[model samples]
Target chain A: MKIFVCVKPVPDTAAKIKVGGGASIDPAGVKFVLGPYDSRAASKAIALRDAAGDGSEVVAVAAGNPNKGESEARKRIKDVLALGADRGILIPDESYENRDPLAVAKALAAAIKNEGEFDLVFTGRQAVDDQAFSVGPMLATLLGVPCVTDVVGLEVDGKTATVKRAAEGRVEVLSVNLPCVITAQRDLAEEQYPKLKEILKANKKKIDTFSFEWPAPAYRVTELSPPPEPAAGKIVGEGPDAVPELVRLLREEAKALSF
Target chain B: MSEFRGVDFFLLDELLTDEELAMREAVRTFVDREFIDNRAIEEHHRAGTFPRDLPQKLGELGVLGPTLPDEYGCLGASSVAYGLMMQELERGDSGLRSFASVQGSLCMYPIYTFGSEEQKRHYLPKMARGELVACFGLTEPDHGSDPGGMETKAVRDGDGWVLNGSKMWITNGGIADIAIVWAKTEEDIRGFIVPTDAPGFSAPSIEGKFSLRASVTSELILQDVRVGPEALLPHSGGLKSPLMCLTQARYGIVWGVIGSMMAVFDEALRYTGSRTQFDRPLSSFQLVQRKLVMMHSELTKAQLIALRLGRLKDEGKMKHYHVSFGKRNNCKAAREVAKLGRELLGANGVCDEYQVMRHLMNIESVYTYEGTNEIHTLALGAHLTGHAAFRG
Candidate 1:
């Protein structure tokens, strides 16, 4: 069985980012990173392949300049490839950087189509940027296969897959078909618990770069603006009075009365 | 010992984000294959030398000199990733790690930093590929802790330098193809990339070692060893050059000590849970619980210190004092944890098969080398108060 995971190189969430002079995300000082959730999804996919034995292969693909030197993004993708992905598919084009989900999804779908056959597709529930959580669904639609978004647990039997998604208050379980897309949620199995030996062997994992036709997409961002900064918070009252005051503010001022 | 302060990788954050999780997984995998099932470790300790081809295996895994700028055939990876790799390597044994430390920080770092253009072009690529074994010569027979007091001298020849000195307790010695020897010239201390094949230069393996037996220890003898001008590291000057190398090694140890301590603690924890004493699991005892709690708390806090320091290193604001603290604290804590682990195991812990005694013995050398616990404390004390405490 052939497994594929859609990984994206993003800004390390731990690193603080400052806006540069232009609309562009200033990568000059930014630390490049593999998306955390995508690592988890990829781990899950690799685990499945390993469980099935030597005939299985885990192919890792990314939606950025996947194998360019000096690009931290590409370096991260390579690191992931080393993590046990049998082969890597890096789409080499700066145009894909910060592109719309539809554009990135199209690039991935085309690669999947080119590969001809795959039993499973895995991806993070959402990329760090904007937290759109749209790529898995978009890719599934483009590939004309079933998709399980925000999946936290997965089980495959024959051509069917039982996926568990973390919902608002409860876990929503859904069964899908083989060759389906899964957006791994953060609540899912941990993405990084690298056993020592695996880290050393990840170097052998193959990473391949590709540049295929993506053509212009219908969707384009009119503007790139920062999300409004959250307003400052202040305590209304102290001690027991604060609780009652918080209730009053929730009921009257903010009108978010959970009680 | 205090909490670990860790390395100052003030520039690693941006570089590590994308591959942090992935690289971590990869390294963990490599460690599992190399260390866990390694048949050579116990034999290595008994034989007193690491496996000859182990370095090549690590190089193939992309771990030998990662984080080095790619020009030198390094991975040019995130500093945190490098630290993580070091930590995992050490979990197996300090002897194994000493090889990497010498290769990466002690040997490769100096060449990358101070070697002449010709030296860098000649030595670095092969070292990264593990085709060449490298050793750092700083500590002398009389100068293990006080490297500045080294009596090694390099006198100028017609177009070269002739070195006269003997370095002591050198790790990865004996078989190193090259050595980064720090010698005090007439005017200043300088680093030299001395080839092992150089006439008058010989490395005799140090015998009768109690700790780090799985690693090679050697005494480097340089009797008027003639070297070309290209051999002298042009950028290295004064006592600071070798001190900087120690800082890098110490920084790596801060994280690595935690890994070893965790392993000892984990083994002890597992053993206590299974061993029945006085009709109860050893873990049921209050004393055992306290030890476990201390080990856990120390491990967590040490981890945080190293992690925070690692962040600083990633950010490009890390300082030597911070690393000094981390080295001092983490090494001391590891020794304590290892001892506690041994105590928890009773007589069984002292045996090789148990592995606690190995760690316990290993931590002793770790404490003494790379700036001893006393040295670090005094350094920190001097930092806190503008005073130099060392006296003849």
Candidate 2:
């Protein structure tokens, strides 16, 4: 079995983000990491490939600008390779940050098609930075294959795959044939921390780079601003005598209570 | 603790190769996830227990004797890369770095440099994988800085040797599977690979340590312990062999203490920036600002020295005295940085909730071990003045 896992480089969740001039985030001082969901997707793909045994291969794919010194997308692809992916493919797009979910899907579909047939393609349910949750379905539609999003568990036997996903506090299991797209949820697999030997071997793995003619964005981010700071707590009074006043303030002035 | 952004005032990151940076980042991430974020360092320190599981994890990361040849299951990392690993490990705790130093430089290094090929084949891979833990036994109850005065003796028996002596202040001594012991023979001082389970060998843990509490320090007793002739490190001839191992460890200490400084400096910076006083953050005061500046300045200088020494070591240009200079200066600088950090944090600094006090206490052990600050100072003095002050 040959598998492909898609990944994205997003700002580390702990980074203090600042909006740059115009509608973009400042790239300066921000550390980029492999998106958490994408990491899970990569782990699942590697595990599947390992189970498949002889002649099985796992390829990691990503798309972003490469002109910038040490492209983050390329680094994220290398990270997956270190986690046991056989090889990698990077699609360079100078304006990737501005691309919508559909645009990214189109680029990934084109890259996959150009690489020939694959047994399966894995992706995160959504990119943490955008939270769009549309790219997997869009890519499957472009490839004309069935897709299952938010998959928490998976088992493959021969040409068929059984997928488990959570819905309304219940798990829904579905079966899909070969050549399908799977968007991984958090429970898809446990994260893998690559051992140093794997990390060193990854430096020798092949990562083919390509350029794509990106489609015009479907929409634009007009402006970006931080969420408003919460208001400070008000002290209406003190002790037991303040209880009636607090109730009155909540019910009348703040209009927070219906009673 | 928030993520460590690395304190590189000199843009040293630009000077490092991508591979070196990646190695450092891997260790940094491991330290954060395994030790810092989970509060394992603090918990283990308070409980006065070693994190026994750490060795396997660190070995998997390929940091154990990382600079050794890859043929022995090691990473064959550059000198600078190994230094970076030490720096990151010590950033978590001095005990952690000390564990690595003892396992790698003191034990595996001597084995690789002096042991027979069979010995390397038998021990290096298992040690690299952390399946076999090893300790160094050079410092004895009667001698530390003057290891030449060691009284441990090995007597030649028909096909083996009988050893009798006691070693003190041994890191990992209590739990080590094997010990690389330096002993005096009729001919000269030699290294013997002694199994800890030898009939008469005993390693008892020393209690009541106020510093490096997360680490284990023990006394090793070899009472007429007998070993086969094969156990001797064939190439080890005299005190110089053990001193060579000490050189390797001291080189790592030069880098390790810098990590302690980074931890404390970063903590102090974060604490003073947010701590409000007199209608403003404590960082606003000139006094506090000066303290921060001094810490940062000293930390940066120490970093430069470590990097230079690492490069020299890689280039085969480093001397034992060079390592002494680096070890002496960096350890003292780190101690001062930790002190300022504690002062900056005020009462909170004394609490384990803040890392400053922990680092402050750990630096004392770091300052004294692998040759104390005063010993190194004298070593450098002898190097500069062409006179040995080590003797009266």
Best by DockQ: 2
iRMSD values, candidates in order:
7.6, 1.6
Worst 10 residues of 2 chain B by lDDT: B1-10
lDDT over C-alpha atoms for residue B190 of model 1: 98
lDDT of 2 by residue, B1-392 (tens): 34676798898887887678777877888898889998999999989999999778888888899889999889888899899999999999999999999999999999999999999999999999888999999999989889999999999998899999999999999989999999999999999999999999999999999899989899999999999999999999999999999999999999998899999988888889898999999999999999999999999999999999999999999999999999999999999999999999999999999898889999998898889998999999999999999977
Docking class of 1: incorrect
Note the B-chain TM-score for every model. 0.93, 0.99
Which window of 10 residues has the lowest lDDT sum in candidate 1 chain B?
A: B1-10
Candidate 1 regions exceeding 4 Å error are A1-80, A83-259, B1-18
TM-score of each: 0.64, 0.93
Alpha carbon deviation, residue B140, candidate 1 (Å) = 1.0
Which one is best on lDDT?
Answer: 2
